[model samples]
Target: MARRKRRKTRVVITGISGRLGQLLTRRLHRLEDHEIIGIDRRFFRRRPKDVEHLRIDIRRKACEDLFRTKKIDVIYHLGLMHDPRRGSQEHHTWNILGTQRVFDYARRHGVPKVVLLSSTDVYGPQDDNPAFISEDAPLLGAQRFSQIRDLISVDMMAQSYFWKAPEIETVVLRPVHILGGVDNAMSNYLRLQRPPVIFGFDPMMQVIHEEDMVSAIHAAATPGLRGIYNVTGPDALPLRRLVGLAGKKPLEMPHVLAPTIARQAWMMRLLDAPAAELEYLRFAVTVDGSRAKQLLRLNPQYSAADSARAALRLGAWDAPSDAANQAEDSKGATAA
Candidate 1:
């Protein structure tokens, strides 16, 4: 009789309801040799047909129950609240404590690897530094809503897990200004009428396409790699240029005036919009991805302009009923 073949290893991902999680799940589902499992509190609208999805809050103790049944080989922890949400405290519970729960589960279950999605926001404001800030650069003082919490969580996870479980490799991917066809806060800002609001001189903006983000996660899971790595697009451009690429113009505003203006415009009520958004406007935040490219062999295909256009064409932002007329008037006023 022929020998029995071993079943392929299964990989689980958190935050299946989120934009990045949805896209990553669809991509990973297409791989024939792996089984994909997605976990989230809410249901996904467009779940891949081949993937298995479990609805459970990672913050709850019940999350450990699922691990007993599935032999998970890898865990991709990508769940977290972006800015503008009123859930910073909840985000910490879910992002930090939830991560700890998953890490504990993986270690106990003998999972070989885990990838934690982090942000370049940890590298705080870059005022005088060079354009491409490498991973070696220090994580400076915080200015944004997500920066402080992300830094604290990543640092704690790195220290606690890396030394304890050497066999269960843990990797962190720090990405900056993630842009793609996903509906997000930054993409919403791009959809506003031209003469788009600018807090000060348009600072240099660096972005990463969502597909490249998935690629970096895949690279992290590949054996023999463990540590933190910065993932970003190859180029950095002025924020105004990026706005123009989305067919919008920049409207200069003083940093001191943004809070009042944003509040008056009633834009602060939007998801992830708050006074914290204005802090990033005063300085440039860039990242050096040479290490990701050299080590992970990741080649990002999309440019900042490409990401801008894709975001617009995909209708990632909601437009008001009179948006066309307002856009036309803004264009006429600018041309005149």
Candidate 2:
């Protein structure tokens, strides 16, 4: 008996050097019939097997040359840079001008589909925000934080392309805090014993496992599903209780002084989260995952609590009491 050959789908993934991008590329490659073309501004240290990695900034002329020659079936725009030192000229140049060039080229080059990775941070964490936010929620990302605010415009651009181009299918995934993976910045911060938190405003928090986030992107990349979807785990929990569930003690810090302290922390590389990120921890910004469930049929295997536990299970974590676990378990159940 001879092995039958499967038709390979030509998939192009940007930001292939990052953890999330690499995860998506690796998983997508597991399918026997998908060829991966990876593009990144920086070099990827560990190149995955069968992936055609290109170290060309999307804004550069070399990138344009590749776009001219390659026939891209679907372009995964996961190239947005999220760092403590974000909002620099380089960040803005790449995220704004860089992505615009890619989008324009994709459109002109007859790419039939696109998968964009946006963030829940686009919706600012307002004190009066609804407990569950849907895709229709207004994008009120913090104007004071250039890093986060820049994402809002990028997200808007992707959405506009989705509506404007009926010829191409575009699916945008707006996921909440992406945690529980070894390489995630947020997860590493939480893995430390006694992670910092706002003193008087421990608002509710929600997280999606790295696996779930990738799954949502996978679902969106499926042909014919073209729309914006809020992707998250099943449950949302109070920030204080979530810390408890993660088996980590919270380092209480006054909001007024947190910026100064967080700046030092960021400098030390102990906490990758900038002071601007504290607003999100202080105010709840939960997203409604109904659209993902209905359209993408994405059933997240990890709940909010599950994600925290996995992320904070590092050596520094303290074991919770049985009674405490029971209480947190109930809270998680109600959240679900």
Candidate 3:
């Protein structure tokens, strides 16, 4: 008698059009046994032919049908909004209500595993923060950066699922500042020809390569893994050195003037982030990845220098094509 072949794992990835999502899709696509289905409001350009891409909002009724019909093995909720440009109400609804819907669907459809990619920024940078923050640290990210509060809510909501749905494995990976060809605050900041740094302040920072972050998620997706874990890359380093590694000259601004300047620049659409975000430059928010290392078996594969170079490389943002323009225009029509 011949041995039986295992069935394919049906995985659904939200935000599959984003850079990090795209990277994860490619990685999982290589494994022929994983059937990939993407749920996003954005169009996935040049996606793998085998991967099914659905341009729909997670909060929509249609999205629920995907769960009701497909026997999904894992759900990767990466659709949380991080763009500060969006209105507060839009941001809150997308991150908070959207998360609630995902969890509800998993519970309703009996999905076994759900992985949420949260950021370590939820811990917030503080003047008196410990040298190595743990996953148990309080989430004060919204204290100064109000925009991050929605994200904190999402992370907390995911945590609630552990108790609310005990049978389902809920793994939340709070990775440090991820660098590489991604459209995040850190990546955008590094893309500046002259990055800004606060005068008289050089806080230590930790960053993970986009690939390493995807790797962490892969490790967390394994069977029977649950709970929150802090994922990090190489050891922490001073902000100035990290900036230098990105091949950009730091434009030092007095702490007093920096906030006002950032606010004004943000208002004029010159800066991507708000003034409160400067706290990361003045205070360290490094996290301990020992839990992930021991449990998820996650190991950072890219060096800080390698991550820096990848962030600065040509076309890091990958300019969108015409289809993307259409997607953007109609994305608001749906519940995101």
Candidate 4:
């Protein structure tokens, strides 16, 4: 009898309902002869018919058992809490313990590769540094308790997994300010009022388009790749200029006074103004992507201005119909 060829393996992704995970699932499903499994707590609005959806919390031990039983080939870990109020205990339970359980299952099931998604906020606040900071730069410990716990979870998982299972290829992607058609914490502020609130004169912001972020993760899992890479877009823009580009005027607000203003806004029920979230607005963090560019061969298609224009044109601020139509025409002209 002739020898039979082995079947092509399947790839599993956690946090499938997230913006990045949804994009990735869609992209991978377009490829021929590859199986994609998505695991998320909530059911996604529009998942491909062929893609298998598993509604499960990764923090639970049973999820690990399910993975071990299925014997998935590659796993992408993209689940984590960003809310500052969640505190260290919650962060450890969800991010660290959850990751460890998944990692253990992958090891037992002989999973080939794992890609862990981390945040560029791990670099901490850069007050006035103009140049981009690379992956080689030391990780500034998270200032807030929530961030500290999240970063620690990622670090411990990455380091321990690498040490224990040298054979399993593990890669970490730290993305900065992921934007594009998503109601993320950062972009929510952009949607607030006409001429978004700006903190100080020089709050430099760098953003990574959601598409490019997914591409980087895809590249990481494509056989023979390991190590950490910082993923960001081409340029960093000042908050004021970014707001202006979004077709909104910029209202300069002093960082010191923002707390008081935010408190009042919260009292008035104008904005969800938690103190921790307010602190995040007051600082700036930027990341360099030279290594990602060179290694992943990724050239992010969207610039900061492009993203701002797109978000504005998408009517994120709920502009009047006439104003939105005019902005759309202007965006078209600029693109041309």
Candidate 5:
């Protein structure tokens, strides 16, 4: 008698309705032997034909039912909250506690693989920061910015799980400035008609196109790929140049007073992220992706600058004319 063929791998992904989540779900759903199971509090325009989407929070006890029913082999933890307001209880509950709950059950259920999505902002922007930061760098992103404290804590949790459970394959991906046609904090900031920039500071930054981010997730799901990986686009661009490339004017301002001004804008709901995120414009937190390229074989198809340009166009910001933008930039004025 012939040997039986192996069963397909059933993979669960949280935040399935999110733009990035949907992208990854669609890609993995098309795979020949991969089953897609999604967990989200909401749904998008449409889901894949065979995907099983459950509208439940990750922390809910009902999650175990999915594992028991599907015998899930791997899970993609991509659910993250991006509210910039300080002391958001929901951010902590969803981003941190939710992760705790997911890992807790996965280990209990004997799930063997987990892939986590983290942001490069964990390194924090500092003048002393090396031009090319690696995984070994200290994650001080939560120092002044308490908003991202949950991200750092969750990152630590993932790292802890990697060591504590030697049998499991835990892969953590920290990508810089994830952007595409989607509108997120970084993307929305970049799409502004005249985004603010720290005076006399032009920090270098990297951005990974959303497509590449999804590709990295796909690679992380492979059998043997497990570890911390830095995924980024091709090149780094200066703050002013980046905005110009996006057909937007740069509003120069003092880094000292920027926080207060930004907070006001945030309260008025003019800007998506709080003042803490503006540190990216003051210092470079550029990451080196050579390890991910060699280990996960992530071939980022889109360049950072090109992604920024395309994202700007897609966001449909009513950017002022080139002459007007130049005039405003020359005055070093402020934007409301």
Candidate 6:
């Protein structure tokens, strides 16, 4: 009898032009059995030769043509927008409708697995939150922060796929503040020369290194794993300690005046995030990652300090000099 050859897994990753998408693409491309297909409206700089990059909106009819033609084994949904400055209607349409289209394509194409990169911020920072929130907790992240409602809607849509399409293994990962060379709000804040802080408030925070988050996504995309999981780093630390780890000083502001100042900054286009994001600075929204550890067999390799250092473009996994990275981060903030 002749030996049989295995087929390559065809993987589709949306938002493939973002920093995290670039990281995931490199990791997956290294695997000989994986064929990478990137879908995004932005340019994929330094794109890998073997990988296919499609610069198109996920909401467009053309996005469905990819599913119609190829045998896509898995879909990594990382296309959810998070910029607070974008209009609410635009955000909702892009996130909710675009995500619905992805799920519809998966169902129609018979894709066996779908992995969504949701954020722990969907849980919303609150004073009454448990010490460690589990997967079953209510998503109140948008209760006060209306801007994130689209994210919450997308998460709920993915969750609905669990029961609606049982054949497709839907895995939603709500990772805590993701810190690295990425241009997210948390990373950008840490890169600030003197990051602002709520006076007399130092909430406990959890963060995952960008690489660890990609690892968790890979684990979730495995053959048998399904359902929602809260992915977290190895440890948690206070907000001030995280800021200190990033080699920055905290400029404390009284809680009463912080929102007003944030609004002014927003009006003057000085702040990347709106005043509503300040809620995260005052309360905790830590999650329990025991499910991911036991089920997905995920063991985070980065410490809180290591993650914080990565945000500043320092340490072993450094990308570029702080000056260069800060400039790029500012230029690329809303691009993703």
Candidate 6 lDDT by residue in tens digits, 14-95: 9998888888887787677889999999999879899998899998999889999999999999988887778889989999
Candidate 3 residue 274 C-alpha distance from true site, Å: 0.7
TM-score of candidate 6 to 2 decimals: 0.92
For model 4, where is the 10-residue window of minimal lDDT?
311-320
* Tens-digit lDDT string for candidate 5 (1-336): 599877888888888888788878766766667788889998655675788888988888888887876688889998877756546788888888888888887888888889999989898998899888999888999887878888999999999987788777999999988877666777887888788999989998788877778888888888877889888876888878878777789898898899999989888988878788888788899998899989888766665555777576452322326423543553453232
Q: How many backbone clashes does candidate 1 have?
A: 3
Per residue, candidate 1 scores C-alpha lDDT tens digits across 203-267 of 88887766667778888888888887888774888888888888887777777777787666656
- Backbone clashes in candidate 3 total 0
Q: Candidate 4: where are CA atoms >4 Å away?
A: 1-6, 84-89, 128-130, 144-148, 194-200, 263-269, 277-283, 310-336
Model 2, stretches more than 4 Å misplaced? 1-4, 182-185, 267-270, 312-336
Q: Cα RMSD (Å) per model? A: 7.8, 5.8, 8.5, 5.6, 8.4, 6.6
> How do the residues 15-81 of candidate 4 rate in per-residue lDDT, one tens digit apiece?
8887778778766876655688888888787787888887988876667666767767789988765
Quality of model 1 by C-alpha lDDT: 0.72
Give the higher-TM-score candidate: 2 or 6. Answer: 6
As a TM-score, model 5 comes out at: 0.89
TM values, all candidates: 0.85, 0.87, 0.92, 0.82, 0.89, 0.92
- In model 3, which runs have C-alpha deviations exceeding 4 angstroms? 1-4, 314-336
From the highest lDDT down, the ranking of the candidates is: 3, 6, 5, 2, 1, 4
Weakest 10 consecutive residues of candidate 3 by summed lDDT: 326-335
Q: Judging by TM-score, tell me the better candidate of 4 and 5.
A: 5
Q: Assess each prediction's global lDDT (C-alpha) against the native.
A: 0.72, 0.78, 0.89, 0.71, 0.81, 0.88
Native-referenced Cα lDDT, model 5: 0.81
lDDT of 2 by residue, 1-336 (tens): 398776588888899878778777766876667888888977776576778988887777777666689788888898887765654776777788867876787888888888888888888888888989999988988654657766787888888887677778988889888876545555876787787888888887878877678778888878888888888776788888877878888999898999999889788977777778777768889888888888998777666667787686432222335424644665686679
On lDDT, the stronger of 1 and 4 is 1
Clashing residue pairs in candidate 1 are: 83-272, 84-272, 84-273
